[model samples]
Target: MLRRLFGDWRPTVLDVLLSLAVGTAGLVESFGRQGSQPGQIGDPVPMAAGAVVAGTMLLLRRRFPVTLLLALIAVGLAVRAVSGGGYYAAWHFYSTLILVHTVASSTEPRSRRGFAGLACVLAAYAFVQTFQHNDVAELMIGAVFVGVAYGSGILLRRQMDQTLRLAERATRLEVEREARARRAVAEERARIARELHDIVSHNVSVMTLHTGGVRMRLGDEHARERDMLLGVEQAGREAVEELRLMLGVLRGTGAPGSGALQPGLDQLDELVTHVREAGLDVRLRIAGEPRPLPPGLGLSAYRVIQEALTNVLKHAHATGADVVITYGRTGLDVEITDDGTGGGPDGPGSDGHGFDGHGSDGHGSDGHGLIGMRERAAMHGGELSAGSVPGGGYGVVARFPLEAPVGVR
Candidate 1:
């Protein structure tokens, strides 16, 4: 046990320290024995030698417990035979007790028969030593020492097993929680896809068909009106294509390699560049020590930034924008503020997204883009708020937790 401490193949510090302590105690007991004590071995040489052997033997207790106990018993008897009196070193006696307890606590000695034999021999050794002195106190104390050591070892084993069981149960519960969360997210995505496909897509398709039919019926004399109708028809087709892409993402069938389909914060620079080229002066600032986020979580944050920037370009008529990402203690915060419009979805320069009638602040627009952004935030147990900033500008802010909740709740 004293060879080393705390390496892969070395004994622990406790083991090494305990062995050293026991060995040191044995040495003191052997040399410091009283000359007047009744039945205590008088000769110091053989008893001291026996003490040292018993002390060293403790090092092997964990690996060869049976052999150690047997060796101690033999050394104790041999010391008795060599000495003038019938007694042996008292330090060896206490050292044997420690080894007995160690063997009882561990599971390496699997044979019950072997353990029973060891217990019998231990009891016999105790009785023989105590018999030398007819005092009732000596006999009782000796027996109590052996019993307590064995009982303590049994208790330790039970405690170790209970701790392991609790750790395993906690791991199982964590796995189940994650699985349930993913399942809920998938189910909600599927439902949204279904609504878009059945109702929204169908309505858009009918409007496009009617527009095409009307444009065809128009006469060549109405040239201006025909060109206007042609523009509407083209816009409707583009909207359908955009809807198809959104549906593909919701249904988990979007091509992974498509840049617009899957985006994480790692590609933030590209997004910033795109917004810059769109004629909106964009300033991207990040605060705090940024850490890697979960893939799905990063993607969600990217989408939020994308949507906010899109709104600023299409609705806010903003000439410049500020995007601030703060990696906070509990989670992350994304804020986008535009210099132009100072209202919500239905405010100045708004495209009528139909948000205010739903009890939103300054929102009564006939659009779903901002609503989709809010839904995305909520899916990750996050919140999104959009309105005018303190000054003469509009802002969108989203907050998401690092260790997010299991589901939307």
Candidate 2:
């Protein structure tokens, strides 16, 4: 609560209350001391009025600090002049000291030094008036008191300046850290893109060229082989197109091939055909009416299914597979299952049966493929899970919201 009141470097209710309390106490002490000194009793009303004025002026100290301090100092001098210069009362000294501290702490360096000098002069004048004998020890004590208040204010100002500098440094460091991380990510992505370009472009170009050469040499005499070669060539061309799209995405460019859209659920049939050509029996089933999904959501769903089917082909040793897509009011759910042992000859739990003997972590033994699928689903506020099915197969399932998050497109 104190921090909240004073944190902004402005006068508040607490400041007003503190001023009133100190002013009232000082007024009462001055009046009480007047009674103890013979013939020193003066007009209580004027003294009380002066205290009230000085205390009320404290409210504007933060906004008009120099003006208020100067006003208070003039009032003190006027009171001393009127009282025949014997000694200023305790309340007068208290108000003067408070104002001196405020001026020193709130003003700029030149102003603070000027105020401190003026305060020292006033302290010397008061010491001379109160101690007519000119005692050196008494003058030195008054000088030290004035110096302490001014020094304390200077110390506080320095501390505040240091705090601000440290805060700025911390903010700069945080910004630099974030910039470094972004640079690292961009560099890594570029490296991966270059490697992918080298591998995919070389292999796909070779496959497409060989398939085309074989198809041309066979002519119509070997129609079956020629037709198969044509399929191979078509598949190679599709792979190249897909690689271009992926490269464009990696490089932050739009999809390639005359603004063609990224592959989505609409391309699932072609994906299944490619897998079938590789000797895997797969069927796709849709349970509800399909709607136009956000591009990112559609793409994520397509990738999950593609990864699951590829896993089935390479690792599940499955003869047949089923791909089920259910579109509901809220979201879409995809399930890919295979009716074969959940392992290949080199895979875990490959005892010619299922993954019954393997642990739960066996599903993730296929490198980062499953992890990548899960990340894709999660990026769209969805989930993916894979495991061995109960009867004699493996299954991969993913769920995604129909409406992609904002900015995903």
Candidate 3:
């Protein structure tokens, strides 16, 4: 309830209650039979009007603190007019201090300072008026409350500034995190695109060449084989044309030149052989219904696997690592994990940023190649993730969607 009154500029239940309480108390004191002399009592009409104005202005102070300050000045003058130079009700002093605090807490530093100065002048004027009437008690009470109100206002303002600073800092950190990730992805994607272009172009060109060579070798007697080879040759040529068209979109988005011929799964055995020869015991596991993959996808899968194994060999420092490829109905999943116990270059407990930074933690984990892997998967409408795995090792996983070949289903 108090928060609503202090923290915002809306009409709140507490504002309503305070308005009613203060207005009613002031009115009752003005009109009710008091011990003061008859001449001290104010005219009923103007005093009642002042009470209502005071209550309404106080209720609106959150939204218009400055305006309320101005209104409080006017209302005090009206009440004083009716009192005929006699003492005013305590409610007038109470309302002035409350509005002063509201303006102090909510206004900007410059405006608050200006308003507070004017308010103190007016408060001193009111206190002097009371002092002349021999009311020392009211002056002392008003002084203490004004000081307390100013203290609380300053504290709340500092708290508000601190909260704003923290919020801005958090927002800036989030933006930096996202931009860092985006730069990584763009770099890797451009490279992946160039690699894809090289892969598909070479594979299709080879197929077209082989088909044409075989067709030329066939004699006129074997008309059926010649016709089949011719058809294959035509298809391969069309595929090359299509590949060229597809690569138009990928041309400008390239990184450095890749190997002349990107290796596919057919080269995995040789890769594994070299790793084993380097003294790393690596195991390969393949599951799912294996089928011939598109040139780009096959090369992409091979690259993902190769990168993982190379990281394990260079960074994992473990005796053994495992690679798994699972072909699903819609896509294939590749996962590589290492024990990190091999006392290798990166040593144990080192994890890469697959969300791992390559070689940052000596595990070639998280932030390492994450953007590239993500781009590769994204090329095929897929995704990738890498990070520390359970049992003191690191893992990288990538998924790529595959389209079944025409007439194969």
Candidate 4:
């Protein structure tokens, strides 16, 4: 508490009160000693006046320390001249020591050195007085007290400076840590994006070529199958286009083409259709008015839905799934659920399909699809969660803010 009260080294009400007490006590002592010796007495009024001046000057010491010290010194000289040079109060010396300490601790090095010289002059004057009175012991004690006060002030000042420097260093380290983390996240995102581009681009290109070949061989004899192949080919083309757009974003390119736009809620129906063609009955239900969304947020939302549906087709043995999209003024929410076997189509013993059990053989079955979906969501300031539902199915849900952060595009 004392440190808090004096931490700034500024004078406050408490300082004023303490100075008042010291001045009053000194005045009382001077009065008490007036008749102690034949010619050692001084006028009570001049002594009290000097003490009052010293205490009043102390109040302004923090703001105008050098000026206050000079004023106090002048008052001390005037009081001695008025008193005929034989008497001095202990509190007067104490007040001078306090001022000396304040100057040492608060001023710049050059100003402090100048004040130290003035203080030495004052000390020498006092010493000369002590010598005239043959009070060697008193002189030694006063000198030691002043030296200690000044030394303590210098130490405190250095400690405070060091504390400030340490605090600044800590802040700098925290900033550097955050910068490093952001760089790592960006690098990881770019790496994942490149891998996705390679995988999806190759698979989609092959699917498009095969579909076109099948349709050509059929030659309109089986219109229905040819139409289905045509639909698949169109979906593959769209997927390739969207992938290109996403790659452009990941690679920090402005856009893949002059008129290209990131796929969003508008293309959700086509996405569901593609999954249905893959042998999973999927339905999309959207709630709320459809409006324009930020490009990044839209892409993230579309990818999340795509991954969820893909998982359903690959693992869920059930014949149907549902996707619900609810849009709010500030955000969008998506939920996808399937009625397939809660674990996998192949039952409990099966570790599901995929390389590591994420979903598809191309990916992993552990949770790669979910992880990628979640990363996409989070990149746009969103969140995603996936798990088996209580009754008997797997579900995935995601929420995204409507507005993208500035500079996201």
**Candidate numbers, best lDDT first, in rank order:** 3, 4, 1, 2
Question: Which structure among the candidates has the greatest lDDT?
Answer: 3
Candidate 1 RMSD to the correct structure: 16.0
Q: Give the per-residue lDDT of model 1 (tens digit) for 258-333.
A: 2233457889999999889989899999998688886566766887788778667766667899999998777889
The candidate 4 region of ten consecutive residues with least summed lDDT is 353-362
Q: How do the residues 1-409 of candidate 4 rate in per-residue lDDT, one tens digit apiece? A: 9766457576689678858976887788677767646555557778777888778777766666556666766787787888765676666776777776776566654575656645653653464354246577866776687777667767777888899999999999999857755555555467446555755676678889999998989965699999999999999999989887787777675422322344667898888888889898898888987777755567678877877777677666668999999987778999988887745644555434221235332333243455567677887788888766888777888988876434545
Better-scoring candidate (lDDT), 1 or 4: 4
TM-score of each: 0.51, 0.50, 0.66, 0.52
Write down the lDDT of every candidate, Cα atoms only.
0.68, 0.67, 0.71, 0.70
- Model 2 lDDT tens row, 1-409: 9666556666689669857965797578557656535445354555566677777777766665567666776666666566543545556556666666666667555675565655554654464346245578867866677667666766777788789899999999999857755555454335334434645566687889988998999968899998889999999999888877676766565422232345678888999999999899999999987887865677668877877777677667789999999987778999999987654544454433222121111223223455456666777789988776889787888999876434546
Clashes of each: 12, 0, 24, 8
* Candidate 1 global CA lDDT score: 0.68
Superposed by TM-score, candidate 1 places the C-alpha of residue 317 at a distance from the truth, in angstroms, of: 43
Candidates in descending TM-score order: 3, 4, 1, 2
Off by over 4 Å in 2: 1-9, 34-36, 81-87, 108-134, 198-203, 210-214, 217-409
Measured by TM-score, the strongest candidate is: 3
lDDT of 4: 0.70
Poorest lDDT segment (10 consecutive residues) of candidate 2? 354-363
The regions of model 1 sitting more than 4 angstroms off are 1-9, 34-41, 108-137, 195-200, 203-207, 218-375, 378-409
